[model samples]
Each structure stands twice: as C-alpha cells, then as structure tokens.
Target: MKSLGSSCSSRAAAETPEASRERRAGRGALWSAWPRCAPRDLAFCMAALLLFCLGSLFIQLNGGPPKVLLELRNYLGESTYLDDHGPPAPKVLPFPSQVIYNRVGKCGSRTVVLLLRILAERHQFNLVSSDIHNKTRLTKHEQVELMRNISTIPQPFLYTRHVHFLNFTRFRIEQPVYINIIRDPINRFLSNYFFRRFGDWRGEQNHLIRTPRMKDDERYLDINVCILENYPECSNPRLFYIVPYFCGQHPQCREPGVWALERAKQNVLENFLLVGILEELEDVLLLLERLLPHYFSDVLTIYKSPAFWKVGNLTGTVKKSMPTLEALQVLYRRMKYEYEFYNFVRDQFHLVKKKIGLKSLLPISSHEPSFLRELTLHTPDPLEEEEEEVEEVEDDAKNWLVQP
Candidate 1:
C-alpha cells in the first residue's frame, strides 16, 4: 500500500513539470510576436510626432496661433455680434469706405489692422469684415462665404481689417470705394525672410530653423508649405499659387467652372485699390487723405516700427540683382505667365491712379534709374565708333598727314 501511494505521488510530480513547460512556451511565443507588432506601434508613434511638429511649426510661423485660437473659441459660441441678445445689431458701417490692403508678408499688416481698429473706436462707421486672419490657403467655398458675409455689411463700414483683393466678389448690392497699400516686392520678400528667420530663433529656439534658400526656378513650395500650414483658408491672391487663380488660369478658367474666380479677378482690379507705400508712404498717405476724406481730416496717424525705426532710406540703396543668368532664365520660364499677369495689374493700377488725379501723390524723384541707364544708355554696340584706339606714330622720323 505504501509503495503504491509513493508511485501516485511521483506521477503527479512529473505532470507538474510538463504543465510549467507549456506555460513557458506560451510566453516565448508572445515575445517572438513583438517585432511583427512593433511596426504598427511605431507607425502610430511617428504619426503623433509629425502632427506635434507640424502644429508647433505653424504656431511659430503665424506669430502665435494661441491668440487667434482664443478669439476663435470665443467667437464660436457667439456667432455674430448681431445675434439675438442685443449686442447692438451690425448696423450699416457709417463710412462708405472699402478696404483693399495689398498685404505683403511682414509688411505692417498687423499694424494696419491695429490702426484700423483704433480708428474704428474714434469713428462711427459700421465694422464690416470677414476678418479671416492667418488663413492664406482657402477652398472655393470658404472664399464665397467670406465675400458673401462682407457684402451684406452696410457701408460705409466703420472699419474692416485683414482683407485682401479677392474679397470684393461678395457684394453685388453696395459697391464701396477700394483702398490698399503696397510695398516693393523685393524689400517685402527680404523683410519676410529675415522676419521668419530671426523671429523663430528668438522666440521659440530653432522652431523655424528650416529657412529655405532662395530658389532659381521660381519654386517657392518650401516656403509656401511652411506658411500654408497655419493659414489654411487664406485667399491672398499675392501668394504664388493664387497667381494662377488671379490670372484666370486653370481651375479658375471662367468656363463651366466657378464664376467666383472671374468675380475675384475683376474685384481685384475695380473694387480693390492699392497705394504703393513702398515708393512713398507720405505720398500714399496724401492720396489716401484725398480719397478717404471721411476717414482722414487732419494729419493721419502713422504706424511706427519698434525695430528699425530710425533706419535710413535703406530701401533704395539695397539693390538685389537677379539671382544669376541661368537662375533668372529658369525663373522666367517657370513664372513668365504670372509675371506678365502681375505687370498687367500694375499697369492697370497706374492707369487708375492717373485717371483719379493721384499721379502726383506717387513719389517722383529727379534721380534717374541707374540700372536702366546702365542697361540702355551705355550698351556698347558694334556699329558705334570704337572707343578703344591704338595710336601708330610709325618708325619714320618725318611723319606726313597720310591716310592708311
């Protein structure tokens, strides 16, 4: 009986070891499966990282999305100031003024907006605006909505801010006189370059460290992508992509497609007006005073820059020659169509200014264009008399007046 009991105990002990081994094998299988599962896990992690980086980059680029986000958040619940609860119905903005700010990046757009806001406080015009700040890349629907909203606002609007040329398409009923301000493209581009380059370094520590080297082929996609992340719905026609749209090129051909494109183009010309502030701010102001008599009575306030306030008339002195012959040609090839379009708009503006008696309001100097003089006046042609001559006083002692 004792031997039999010992045998049963031994059999049970042997089975226990086998059970433990099976459990160990199951754990080993789980470990082997880890590498196969790791990729999905890594993908999720990588996507999260990209989103974080993009968000950070956009905030840095746009100069604090935090403030804008806060404003938007507040606005979401209270759709309009004219909504039910007596927040003062959006009345006809008393001033019969239209806003046509030719916004160059980093060229005092914010200051202009602030200035307009301040002016609004003092004046009684209704504040009419779509006010889509930091929205540089927009779909057609959004553009339509923005115009539609602004169109309904009774003028003269007390104030509108952050509006661009394309926004004039909404108003069929009331046509407001257009006003805009422009800076030299070169100066504007340089200012924008430095602004993005330095602003990120100072504020956020290499957040915008990816400053794109200026390209020759007119490819600005690198910079455009950076700017677009933040301003997803901006319809600024001045941007590189929108140039095609503004010119009535593809996607905006005015055929079976959208009338929005054609409307936007005309509004940029007729409804939108720009004062070339780059050439002469004072002259531009004088013109503005004449045109916007209701808004300007005495000397209008000028916005002073915090930095570079006393910087001399550096704008003219800083001459940027075209990148290189090869580069210039390449760029011309890529952007010739848009360049022609821009020139067309520029000529139209010139004509409009002349008709309105605002030509003198533009800055004119006796100083001739040095580059033009060098290019046109001094070009040496083979047909012209050769300036280089070698005198031949021959080996002969006596020289007669002889024609060789």
Candidate 2:
C-alpha cells in the first residue's frame, strides 16, 4: 500500500504542474486575441466625447435651450419664459451738442446774450457771438460759407447772431438746435425807432456814431408822422421785420402777407426749440436753464444777480415816446401779419411753459383786436432802464431810415 501511495503522490504533483502551465498559457492567448486598445485610439475616443459636450454647451448658450430641455426645466420648478414680442426698442437719442440763437432785434436778445456770456464762463461751454449785426440776410454763397464756419466750431457750442433763419439742412450741414425771443410788434418798432435816434445811456452821440449818414431831420422825425405819412421806414415791407428772422432767406419772407406769416409759424414749430416772449424774460432764462443745462445752467441766477441789475439800471434809451392812439391804430392795422405771428409765438410759448411745470406770470390772453386796444389803454411808461451794455449798439441803418 505504501509503495502504491508514493507513486500516486508523485504522479499527482507532476500532473498539477502541467495543468497550471496549461491554464496560464490559455489566459495569455485569450488576452492577446481579444481587442487590444492602443493608447492613441483611447485618447481619440475621449477627445470626441469632450468635443460633443462643448458643442452642445455652445448651442445652448447662443440659440437658447431646445424646446424639450426648456419644458423639462419648467417642469422641474424653474419659472422661465421667452419674450416672443418684437425686437427691443431703439436706444434713446444722445443730447444735442450744438445750439443756435439767431436772435431777433429789439426783443430782449441783448439781455439774454449778456446772461449767456456769464453762463458760458460758469458752465465751461463755447459761446460764439457773431460781431456781424448788420448782415442778417446772407447770399447763398455767403450762407454756405457761414454754415461751414459754424460747423467748424468745436462741439458743445452756442452761436448767437442777429441773423435771419439759415437753413443748415438745405446746405447739407447738421442743423443746430434753434432758440429766439420776440416782443409785441408795435413795442419792438417803437424801441427801434427811438434807439436809432438817441441810442441808450451812452449818450445822444452814440446814434451818430452808429448811423453816420442819418440827417438830423430823419434822426429827429416824430413817431406819428413816420407811421401816419407812410414813410419808407414805417411802411409795410419795413414794418414786416420780425417774421423774416424766422421765415428763412426766401425773398417772399420780407413781404407782409399770409405766405410769410404761415412760413414763419411753421419754422417756429419745426426748427425752433423755444421762441420766448420778451414780456416773460425771466421765464425765458428759466427755460434755457432747464432745456440746456450744459450751456445755460444758472443763467437765471446770473441774470437776477445784484451786480447784473446794477449794470442794467445804468442803461436806458433816451427820449422814447409812444405814438398817438390814431397812429397806433393805423400801425396795428398795417402790422396785421406781425401781430398774428406774435400771437402764435406767444401761444406756443405758453404751451411750453405749461409743459415744463412753470407758472406763467403773464396769463394766456385773447388774440382779438381788443387786445391791442387794451395794450394801448394800459401802455406802460417807456423803459426807464435796460439790461444791455452801453457799448452794445445795433446797426441803426438796419433798424430804421433804410428801405428794404
């Protein structure tokens, strides 16, 4: 039995070693035959998976999520909705950088200009006040040149002149915002009438220097005679002064008729940002401050300053007299167009005042002929003082004693 057991044990050990070797060989063959993944193939598969994730993220960001995804998100307690309305509204326009004040004569422009000088300094804006007061109407070539010059002025500038309306748009130039002031037609006429003769506080000699060619007879002409006798200075075309300032450079603008009147009113509506009345001078300055803070901020404060009043009190036109009631009535009839434009401007101004939450000291009034009669009945005394410098003299030739 011992001999048989030893032989069996030796056989089993040999068999066990052989079986182990066979099993190891089988495992090695199976591993080699199965798909062998190279390092490059594994890296390529990972790169493809990464790129697909990135592309889906890009699509989600730009085109918004897919409808199914959006619905899934909403179902999962996310409250999101798309705006299927039209495209967003256009952006608001930037503020105006260029402003123009083609000022009308004898209408408190001097006062406004004086305030502007101080304002320009205080607010750090460019104020270009034209020295050419005589040439309100310019030729076409001249208009082109002038508009070019004004355009060349630096941005955020305010240019003022005693000039008629210039169509910058017609000249293919950017139009600057416009502003102006006007007074009662008859009042403006009277002020110019006396200002040409005696001038202001500088003395009677001031008129002589301004109107060197005026004879003593014409200089000293009575107001009643000038209007009643149909003198060239007081007649239709000449008395048709203020409208031309608003009616542009068209030749017909100088004519006192419906055409010029309607054109002037249209220009005021389309071009002018504000056309103030001289009677409401304070309100004009306030509006200026509100509308153009960069250019005219604190203008009313400077205008109402004690030092400004001191300078203003020292200046007044000498020997201004109102015409007789009959002469005034005749003048009113002749200036029918002027009064019509004036009334229209006043109404527009009052509307603006109401818009800006401003309380007008001068209430809106009727446009009847009775208004003129009432004006005559309550004709205030001639100006005892004015708010312009003594050295600032308008061209007497343009205002009086010259045919258009």
Candidate 3:
C-alpha cells in the first residue's frame, strides 16, 4: 500500500508541470499575435471613434433654429445685392454738382451708399461722406472746417454728410442742383422710432427719459435736467415740421404756432433744387433724367439696378415696435412734425405732377409689377425651392440722406 501511494503522488506532480507549460505557451501565442495586427486594429478603432464624434456634433448644430424665408429665390448660401460679377461701367455724372440728397432714414440708405461708391469707382468720380452719428448739428466752425477739408479732397470723391442744407463754404460748382428724397412720413418716423428702440443701430440710445429737453434751450440746463423737463433734443417749443432742422432752426420751437410750418415750407421751396417725392419715386427718377439730361442717359437703367436698400434683397425686419403700444404712440406724437411735413410734401408733389402733366407716368400701385415699381418697392422674388420668400427691388437711394 505504501509503494502504491508514493507512485500516485509522483504521477500527479508530473502532470501538473505539463499543464502549467501549456497554459503559458497559449498566453505567449495570443500576445505575439496582437503585436503583429496592432497597426490595422488600432486604425480601425480610431476611425470608428472619430466618425461617431463628428456625427454627434453635426446633429447638435442643425437641431434647432428659426426659419424665415421671406424671399430668397437665389439665396445660394448668403449672397448679396451687388452681383459678384459687378455691373458694367456707369455713365458719369459731373463733379462739382452740389447735390443736396435729402436722405430720409430707413429708406434704403446702405444700398445707395454702395451704388454711389460703385459708380464713383467705375467712373473715377470723387466721393466724400460725413459721419452724422456723433454730431447732428455741425457748428459754423465745423462747417468752415468741413469746407476747408472739402477743397483738399481728391477728384471724384463722393462727398456726403448729415446736413440740413447746402452751405458749402468753398464749393464753386456750377448750376448746383439740390436733390431731396422724401418718403411717407408715417413710415419714416415709425422706422426711425423702432430702429432706435430695438436695433443695434447708432442714433439716440435711450428711449425713456424722465423729461424731454429741446435742442434749442440746452444752453440753460444740463442733459439730465433737460431730459427731466421732457425736453426733446431740439429745444424748439412745438413739433411742426421736419425742415426746421435743415432751415438752420431748432427742431423744437419755443412757441407753438403755424409760423414754423410756414418757415419750413419756405425753406423747402427756396433752398431745395429737386425734391424727389418717394411716393412718386419713378416719376422723381424721370424728373432727374430731365434735370441732369447731360449726365444721365440711362437714368432708368442705373436706377433699375441695385442702388440703395437692394430693394428685393432686403430680408430681415428692422426692429420697429417696442414692448408697449402706449410708448409707440407717444413716440408718434413726439414726431408729429414728420407726419405734418410728409403730408405737406406729398401735397406739393401732387401739385407739381398736376402742373407738369406727369401724373400718368407714376408707377402702378403696390400690386403692379412694372419694372420701375419693382425697383422702388423692393418686392422680393419667389423662391424656387420649398423655402420662405422676400420681395426685393432696386432703389434710387434716398434713404442715405436721412440716415445719420
């Protein structure tokens, strides 16, 4: 029995050693195989990981956004009004032409600037523009300074400034024709009020004031105190007309009377050369063609092209209304002068059209799609695909005159 037990123990010990050797050999084989295939295996894993991350990012980015496709038939990504290829060389208007562009704000000023700049570039005309954002009222000293500077400007300079009238200190241009652009007063005032209220545009920053101060009487009070008195920027007593500012008078009057309106009308009749009524924009252009016949052979052609506001191309709505209706009404009342002036101007324009027998030449109503109307209203083109549409039109660029 002792001999058999010893033999069994020896046999078990020998089997254990063989089994250990087999296990170690299997592990070694597996480790060696991994190294040989490591490059391809790692590459596959990394590729899969990268693709998964990219897919997640894409889904997150396009998940949610407001879609307003008012009129974007050819909206290839984010295109512009100026054709990438640009227009042909424009016919040149003479230099030294005293142009009083009565720029009405929010009427398509930017487009006008671009058009003027483009035309200047093509025709080698001088272009100079003034920054009205800071100082609406240019002092006599400032005017002198501006004139002195104007003499030094290079040829073909497109000169523009925020001016109420043309009092060029040193300009010696011949038959200097003044140009004024007019729009519906209600629309113009509303646009100006809203743009100042909501958009990031540079103009009057604050909508609320404890008091409104007038521009005329600011000499007696500080800005804070004047606002407390509810004085408007111009210290004139009453809101009567838009032309008072241009006529070298205070925007607000010290006394409320009809004289302010009469004075403004006198200024318009005497000072302005060509008042382009925006209500009769197409007719205005035709008038310009007749007035500047020596320079504008293709007045309609150039006007039909993009000038200001890129009519059909404009997409977004400028912030016009505030949170409360009462606030809006108050602003309208404050700007009542604009409404009065607008009606007066429209009436004058109608009288002129009647006098000249040009009433038949006016563009069709808002519904009509005559080529000229398309240019003035900026009605957008219909989108070919399933997206929103916006109407776009060409502009004669009266808005630039109004903008600061």
Error of 2 at 355 (Å): 1.1
lDDT of 3 by residue, 254-369 (tens): 23346656666676676665565555666776765666443333445666775543543452235543212233233345555555566566666666666777765543332221
What local lDDT score does residue 324 receive in model 1, on the 0 to 100 scale?
22
Clashing pairs in 2: none
Per-candidate Cα lDDT values, in order, are: 0.46, 0.81, 0.50
lDDT of each residue in 1-404, candidate 2, tens digit only: 56988998887787877798898999999999998799999999999999989979988788876688778877887533334545666534326778899998888777777878888788777899988889998899999999999999877789999999999999789998999999888888988899888888756588888888999899999889998899999988889999999999998888888998899999999999899988788898888788877887777788889999776654566787767656876787788899888989988988898898988764645444323434444555445464232112222211221222
Quote the RMSD, in angstroms, for model 2: 16.4
Task: Tell me the tens digit of each residue's lDDT in model 1 across 1-404.
Answer: 56988998887777877797998999999999876657789899899999999999999998877887778878786566556565785545424455434354444455455555545555644544434555644566765665566666555553344433443434343444565554433334435544544342224434244435534332233333334332321113333432323322224532222354345456566555453443445555555556665554332443344332333222221222223223222333333333334444455556656777756443332222112222233333533344332122111111221212
User: In model 1, which range of ten residues has the least summed lDDT?
Assistant: 390-399
Angstrom error at residue 75, model 3: 50
Candidate number of the best lDDT: 2
Put the candidates in TM-score order, highest first. Answer: 2, 3, 1
